[model samples]
Target: MKKQFFCAAAAALAMISAAPAQAQPQTQDDPYQWLENIEGEKALDWVRAQNARSQEALEADPRFAPMYEEALSVLTSKARLALGSIHNGYVYNFWQDDEHVRGVWRRASVESYRAGAPEWETLVDVDALAEEEDRNWVWGGVDCLSPDYTHCMVELSDGGSDAAFWREFDSSDKAFVEGGFYIPEGKSSVAWLGPDTLLVGADTGEGSLTTSGYPRTVRRLARDAALDEAPVLYEGEETDVAVAAAVEQDNGGAHVFVVRSPSFFESEYYYARSEDDALGDLEKLPLPMNADFEGVLGGRAIFLLREEWTYDGETYESGAVIAYGLAGAEAQTVMTPAANQSVEDVEIGKSGLVISYLEDVSGKAARFTPRKKGGWKRKEIGLPDNGVIEIISAGGGTDDAMLSFESLTRPEALYYAPARGKLKKIAETPAFYDATGVVVEQRFATSADGTKVPYFIMGLDSVLKQGNAPTVQYGYGGFLIPILPVYYEDPARPQHGALAGLMWVKRGGVLVLSNIRGGGEYGPKWHQAALKENRQRAFDDFIAISEDLIETGVTSPEKLGAIGRSNGGLLMGAMLTQRPDLYAAIDCGVPLFDMKRYNKLLAGASWMGEYGDPDIPEEWAYISKYSPYQNLKAGEPYPKVLFYTSTKDDRVHPGHARKAAAKMDGLGYDFFYYENIEGGHGGTANQDQLAYRTALEYAYFARMLMPRSE
Candidate 1:
């Protein structure tokens, strides 16, 4: 259910937990600042040399080849469900495999897709385009005109970077329109206002982007007109995160929205009556700054509250879903979470809202339809309970959805559910590894502050009874993301227990997914519990889980390993420096280590709403205590960590890993380091690259935690 009207703050905040980094000024205290030079030969030389060394060491292991093959096989398996969404009477899908490593944009009729056998028509072959143009192009996404959906804007990223080039595409003809609407790359956003017009937010020139490196100004670009000369609809402050535009064209007309995000969580929304409206024609919507724009439904704009707000003299509590009429009516309540409930994924379908939520750390889903009489009519979509549920594909002009259900040990089942219709099991992935003896269970660990932190532990029942087993705990406790016990995650680039099952668990290692504070497992309150100064609570929660594992005789400190990326990578750093004795190895991938300078690097400034600004002395007082780089001590019993990042990770600075590794090297600590030359924040561009990295990770874990014979 990805629409132009996603939570602006959450989208920006994702860069912290879901992306990578680079770019910063050199300081006297930072000796490894040269690594921040994204394309500098000197920096690249160091990265290349380190990659060679780490790859040799990890790939030399006997288990590496088989693991790589298995990962590749699973990633490229055709039996895997083709997750797609209905668009213009068809279901569109972006596919990648061993053949189409760069991926292909394909679509099939809705009937064929629902029948579980889509005769895909290739719209754009990225692998062919990359070869023909001699460019490292990655498929970004496409924004199309509503209804017809023939005219579209195709986004193409260079080597999987966030910044991308948008070109006019004609889906009807399946070709790029010559000299059609084009927006140059630079953390941009766009939507079709009409057949000949687009509402765009992009880096036009100097001062066009916010301090966070996102477009602060949005303009209306006419077909065949110069992007620079387009009419500026609105301008936000330089300090603001960014400004974005979305168009909702329906029976009424084209309703334009410009969301001006001043911070990660605060925003001001402006609206236009029609696509022809000018800058002055835009009217500001009276809404709370902390309120998030979900999407428009039945002439009303949907919102989710992150804080209590008395709107129109009525109070709406945090975590409440509300809707406001476009004709300027009082805000009405949509859905209020129950005592044990918190919403997770929200997708706006053509006629309904598909909400996948959590109840006491478990998954549930329902479709909310706007009733003519008033209030939202909720219809629960029945699926397997007590497992991870993901809305694979929804919206895109259809009430039908692609849903996935899986537990830690169970293979994922893909279902096609129609609006108020029965759930049809269209596809299911075969078990990657034998899970005959494997079992998954929910457990709670008491944190330092006496909060019950939920976590999922999966392994062989016999192994649990044996009392001690090598274990890997994976966590990402920030950005409202709940780490569910799915056998895998993201069909586009699947990883998790799915690969770990084949590579680690099957080889006698345990897997754990921690739902600590700073995540959405228990909703907003759970996340707020670990904000800024309280960030250590997340680390404490993770530490408590490790202690519980050892106390319960599950595994020992010498057999434990912690793995996380991005913000979770920061968590790993905290674990490495703060509680090194608890784990045998730490996989800190594309992590933010230099907390003091994080805001000054890449897109880190946008995340100030999450981790407070380090320049603020008061904030530094709380941050410095756990800031990994500044806190790194020479004699600390830090684990031999495996630090990895991408050379072009434009979200979190690669220098974070490079600097920390260099500092550790200076301290005479022996550790492994690797950097992918082509991957971006995700650290891998294609299935093969993903397979290679997956194999490397499992091999490292195998060597560090598994038994010698394995």
Candidate 2:
């Protein structure tokens, strides 16, 4: 799996505690409240029963086995490109396959990696480590020291949970350092201050964490000192979400900084006075509370604004990139997007900054150089049009960087761009499935409020022309996360839509990706438009897209299906209760069903900034309008939805899905439910498990939406 944020572990801590006082009133009224006891005996029994029923029904289908095999082949194919980040003089990657179930940390020289035939040298084999330690060890990631990049800290999770243990490792010897810096299992953040020192934020003892269960104190620890003996560097309020410390290194210089997140969307930043300055006496950086500190580039601190800011009598709009000198507070605008564009990401190079932005939801990138006189200059990087471009690796003590590009019909291709040269293709992934006759088109649907929502449709021209083809529309319209088009190869990423093409579109089904409101497609304003009371706008936008598809003759009510997970799973729930007559099947994965009690669940309290607090009567008044569990009415023509969640999902509680299914059962509605014993919020632990779960989803859609000939 990719590196998950330490805040995930902090969120998981809520699972062990009782629900907040705000939920006490509803607890008595809920008959299924006992199901919230995640690992209780009775709860496991109920989960097992539902899992068996779901597996027996879906796996028994004639199409399940073949689809599973096809998915497995694509997942474990050796022809897939092994992408990695450039560090020191080598490219580092963590790889897993059928043979190595747990994966391995390996490295190769930049020349060899760029040559397309990397000669990999294994640093740590997780499967072997798991066997030796007698634990189900899952690879988290490694944070290496800059410059030489010899000493590092490796993270390991148990059973794919968010909580993990950290240990010091020696890259030169390819082994765990004996009697070196180590942090016991917890949701912790650690960064190297020096070879023998680290800035840490972890569970020190009682009262060390915030109300949201994240570390509220940052400490400076010496290599030879015990964790409890470490000196406190900085401390935040108990109401804060989290406090983290980091050391940013680049060609310009190295700087130490601390961040205090009071909520999911707001933060306060502090910087050390000098390299050798005391951490406890840091100076605060004067910047907007709703801005993200990107990094230090060329002696300037880069920031991406989430809200409009007025600094030095100059206004910087939201979604703009601005920079200030590390030694001074004067800010200058680096880049700003057009009305239809949003800056997606920013990365520091050796001497310049590389930015990835979206124009009308299409990906574009450029390099910004600081002019000798004053302002900055921009040079557009040439890339394939109508596709998503991502910065794979950058700012690893070099001016050269690597990027990847892909689209619905186009396979992924990696490119290497040097400081002074053009982009050269270094590697390309072979198409997993044939797309000779595939047609990709962008369309717009007028939403309930007359807003134009853009979406992508992929299918065979002949099949779409015939009309009424089995189709599945997917969306996630929250957290400012923009859904883009790409051919997915990594099971760990999960955001790619290529798997749909192989498993559904190649089999004569249509695929639709919705770019609705509450996304970063057009910038922060797009997301703010759907916050709190206006959250229904996102649901309305999705429903409008589905209706437009039917009206265009791409699919009918009986031939249409919908899929979403996590926040998107909440979208699935809204669709189920509000527009049951429009969809034939619903795949709701790890969803939040009972909105009234969502804030009491794991990590749900942290998202009150996005979804209003139900405890407040004023907010609940609007939330109650579309709370799926509260709105499900009897005698309604609802589709048979398949609900899947993980028992180890420390983020979203499994009870959300379980109670939803149980209520449907009580209402005489039939639905499918599956709960994996492992896997965190992702719902799968490894490639095989991912393939099996994916196959089950496709099979369920086939049974519900595809026509049968007897």
Candidate 3:
């Protein structure tokens, strides 16, 4: 069995509460008509008292002392993010090539900054723009853009169906090529060979199945003398396993390099020039260890090899990134965060590396550039005094690009800068809601374990903190994604603002965000405190926070409510089963309930690296102990919870949520369930649909947590 070795007594006691009594309801004059009911007041009082009890537990628990230290780090180090480009200059400005917001392409230029030098700009947003007719059948769009940006290659569906067609986008003429080649879709992608010629790697039915599933073939495309020319670069070794193809150079004419990795431990690269077939040297990135190679990124192929043995006697943080350089070279460790710290996003350019990582130091974000020799140019991008800095995109020249910026009181803004200097504002989105009257404060509460948890107190602060205000709290405790303030303030636009629950807030409800563990709040160490077998620690911490809030007289569980999505949904599920007496209502959306089979589902397997593979006996033993679906017993009273999932969710199988509801219903549990039939991962497809979904959530929260008859 693996353990973190370092243990604090306070942390352990905070993991379970010995006292959890419902608090007395606090009365208020003119406490919004919507929250005038006894049910609302009771719920509010319940959570408030729970929160207080949790605080007392922390004071008495020495094992949980570490949690408070970590929470303080998170609160003090939240980075204030800024946006910029750092590669070539012309492409740094944000541009939209696709009409669909998600599909829109941004091209910003990056240029080097010298003393008294003129700034340079380059083409960045060279992307496929979808015409009205382009969105007809397939979920496809433009392929590659010509070197001079005069011609664009479009990948259309076969017969306007699921199959794809390859056509050229000639900007000079503003029309597609007269005729096009049929490029079958698989793990295939297109690379430009010339202004008019393309290198497309595709697989047909016999080669790669055109249907919506997995396993496909690989090939390269080129221009043919006749309109109907077959594209056959090379046939890959036949196997059921779908290997990912990596393209090294994006803009080049001398030679094109293609790297193929069947697994993280092994890889093969083939290089060719001008449609000529002379496969170059095959490079293998071998790690003398048992590791799972994810996929390829940048010009190098990536692998996450788990060291079977612990490093310095610690098994919690043991994965490393091995980057295999093309052209038969040694695999270099391009980047590595603190042990156990999860890497969020990595942007590598000619300059170095800008990695967006979960807490590694002080629980805030840090930027590091690889020194030309052997080490790294690391610095804390000091946005912490205001808020957390999230690096959206970086690359244009050697030291610049546009970055998306935001803070507690600021909406997202695009900051234009040349390098490690001053940032000038370029653009910002219009706020659909007014937050002029709302105030958001960052506060830390000591948990039962003495671990401090950071939470955002948002609402009308003029009201006393001890008032019986209706409150809605949100939290997510899975994966390492952080919850930073969105600088979201809009009172008028209830649907778009934090006031999504404003129906309750407008009715005097306070909205709160708990930065629970199992998140990258205070770096990797903070998250490791509540992982796998220790997963219950996250739940304990959350319950403790709720207890503290109630004890502080913010709102009791009766008028208090909880909401979470995805893993947060799983958090809610756990809360409902483990401590249903503490919460009045819970909104669990797209959650994984069946812990026994979570790994068998779509996208669930990938999470095994994070959540641990339940199939494994050692890991399963711990997972089973807290598995929500298995732990739900018959005849136990549960909270009024609403479970939501999407039928079209291609990721975590909707079955987890669907079956949980069915089982709960059959077992006679009281809950609400709604499953959308469209929209893949998200329960809803578009913005309009999102508004409706949010409206329903607010309505449900208002009805249960802010009843109108106290």
lDDT, candidate 3, at 347:
51
| Candidate 2 lDDT, 434-520, residue by residue in tens | 888889899999999999999999998889999899999988888787778878644633335567778888888998989999888
TM-score of each: 0.95, 0.96, 0.65
Q: List the residue pairs that clash in candidate 2.
A: none
Pairs clashing in candidate 1? 20-651, 20-652, 21-651, 21-652, 21-653, 22-653, 487-498
List candidate 1 stretches off by more than 4 Å: 1-25, 275-280, 491-495, 707-710
Compared with the true structure, what per-residue lDDT tens digits does model 3 show for residues 245-286?
Answer: 333333343345443433222234454444333345433433
Which has the higher lDDT value, candidate number 1 or candidate number 3?
1
Q: How many angstroms is residue 409 displaced in model 1 relative to the true structure, after the best TM-score fit?
A: 2.5
Per-model root-mean-square deviation over C-alphas: 2.8, 2.6, 14.2
How much lDDT does each candidate structure score?
0.81, 0.83, 0.50
Query: Model 3 reaches what TM-score against the true structure?
Result: 0.65
Give the backbone clash total of model 3. 98
State in Å the error of residue 255, model 2.
1.2
Candidate 3 versus truth, CA RMSD in Å, comes to 14.2
Which residue runs does candidate 3 get wrong by more than 4 Å?
1-242, 250-281, 286-344, 355-384, 396-398, 430-432, 444-453, 488-507, 523-531, 612-620
